[model samples]
Target: MLTELIEIIKDTFLPTIVVTGDTALKTDLALDSFEIINLIGILEDKYKIEINVIDIVSLITLEDICNYIANKKMP
Candidate 1:
């Protein structure tokens, strides 16, 4: 899932420079507030999970996003 998320990020945002784990989303990926929303929409649609704005604010890293989706699984 992490790998898939990384791929999605890469495909969604074509970074001019190399992106690594340490790279920040707002700086390296240039993902601003609006892009974040767009990303959430894509993720929600792709994963079939509902994402809240608070969830988006709480996410800082790729792992965070993956973990959020993982935890939202309907049991």
Candidate 2:
């Protein structure tokens, strides 16, 4: 899941950059407000889960996104 999430982030936002689990979505990648909004949309569609707007602030790293999606996903 981590690898796949990395790929999605790469394809959607950072096409030429390599992102790791510890990479900060905002600090390291410099994702702005609009980009974060777009990321939420892409993540919802790709993962088939609904992400609350309030959770956006908690998603600070790639690992955070992976964990959040993992919890939201049905078994």
Q: Report backbone clashes per prediction.
A: 0, 0
Q: Provide the overall lDDT of each model, using Cα atoms, as 2-decimal numbers.
A: 0.79, 0.90
Best by TM-score: 2
lDDT of 2 at 35: 91
Which is the leading candidate under lDDT? 2
Q: Candidate 2: which stretches are off by over 4 Å? A: none
User: Which clashing pairs does model 1 show?
Assistant: none
The root-mean-square deviation over C-alpha atoms between each candidate and the true structure, in angstroms, is: 2.0, 1.2
TM-score of each predicted structure versus truth: 0.82, 0.91
Error of 2 at 1 (Å): 1.1
lDDT of 1 by residue, 1-75 (tens): 777887778788863556554556676577899988888899999999999887677787777788889999847
- Residues 2-42 of candidate 2 have per-residue lDDT tens digits of 89988988888888987899999899999999999998898
